[model samples]
Target: MVSRGYKKRGVGVMGLRHVKNPILLARAMLEHGEDDLEANPRGVNSGDLDVPSAQGHTQLYGKAAEQLAQQYELELVDPSYFFTQRRWDEHVRALEREKKGQGQATWSATEYLPQGTCGAVALDQDGVICAATSTGGLTNKLTGRIGDTPAIGSGFWAEEWAEDGDPTGSSTWDR
Candidate 1:
């Protein structure tokens, strides 16, 4: 599961039971469906193809991924695998803070806050760029709220680039 969120950002992936790493899961989901994209030219390099609705994030913690896992012979661990004393302690602290009205005031502090996502961006050996990210979300949050991390273009996005007139290859990419 993508994990739950705070008042600002909701849990992006809900009810994830056995998956250990969402980043890897997200990457797997991408790689798993890349062939389908390659076979269909209409989706190639199109942002629409990379959108969240098409990325299958909505199929979490249910029959869809479970069925796929079974078909692929993938191992599914108990949700207890995600349990940790440290995480529980953090959740307790967050709740205490909220009760005292000491919670964070802004969502923009995500990168610097105690809770945040992990991401990796790389220019692969084939010169193809790819990015991936995942988060456990805010502690003691609503389990059904999906955070931005699993929201495709919001938390992670990659697109091929080519410069038409820049010979020095110094053009900047902007969202």
Candidate 2:
């Protein structure tokens, strides 16, 4: 999802869950959030097409759900307009260089990203399956980069299976 905040400053933490277990993570995230900018930057040289919504600091856990109601622009580029203008510009320039194949390339995107994450896939006594994931995402990640920790199928998934063994579990992607 193209996470964005309608204000110059907002939140950045993201969560995706198929069950209620992940709410715990959200509660914890709320406690750790800090004041940060949360605007959809414009005019940036989004050479890689990954425009970040949060600059300097990814909002701890606000403004993500708003993406659902946000109209998908045909080509949302340039992560500018953030409250920390200087930092946003520097990062965007790096992103542009990366797109031009002149910036650092030895490390994969995940290497520099925040690695601490929590995920759960559980089957309860009632045979109910649930899944959820939590992450702050890359505090300094490339714009618009979707981390596996929050992606539905790629991060965490859960499905119920029949005792007959004729059925298989599925993810949101499969559905």
Candidate 3:
């Protein structure tokens, strides 16, 4: 699975995975004392934490994940998103191809991947594990836009064990 450092500080476990649905979670946090809505109107951006991508939707996913965790009473752990570095590289290559007049001329065609993927893993206090992912199909991506995020076993995985036994079970998901 691909991994990267999560930078939005103070996005504790609560801010990370507990707040599923970035937009909704952000609104809730603003009502509470957990987050500053005004300062971060667009949720948390990638640069706030040094991750790549001109933008990062981790906060949005985190919020949605958090709501699910709480609704299910699951103990939230390190909530994160994984995207293939190759996919990003491919996006760049596509831009080059377009620059060479081999592809579409639209700006969105070059600025962002036609689609993106994300995943989340959660564990309960008793150690049950759950994995989830979100993504849009890889339609119309430039030749270089590799769509690995939705690939099974390549995007996300999780493991957990019973308190009194061997590993209880594991859950995995693809976009």
Models sorted by TM-score, best on top: 1, 2, 3
Top candidate by lDDT: 1
Candidate with maximal TM-score: 1
lDDT of 1: 0.50
lDDT of each: 0.50, 0.40, 0.40
Off by over 4 Å in 3: 1-100, 103-110, 113-116, 142-146, 161-175
lDDT by residue for model 3 (1-175), tens:
2222221111112224333343333223322322322232233765433212112223323344454335334454443443467666865765676677755553454445545456666555755555555554453455434354523345544444335433534533221
Q: What lDDT tens digits, residue by residue, belong to model 1 across residues 110-156? A: 32346556776667577666665666677666667766666645765
lDDT string for model 2 (1-175, tens) is: 1121222121223433221223443322322333323445444674423223323433333234323112222122233422355545555665766667765533445335344466555555765555545654444566566676654345544544445432455655456
Candidate 2 structure lDDT: 0.40
Candidate scoring better on TM-score of 1 and 2: 1
Cα error, candidate 3, residue 96 (Å): 13
TM-scores vs. true structure, each candidate: 0.61, 0.35, 0.27
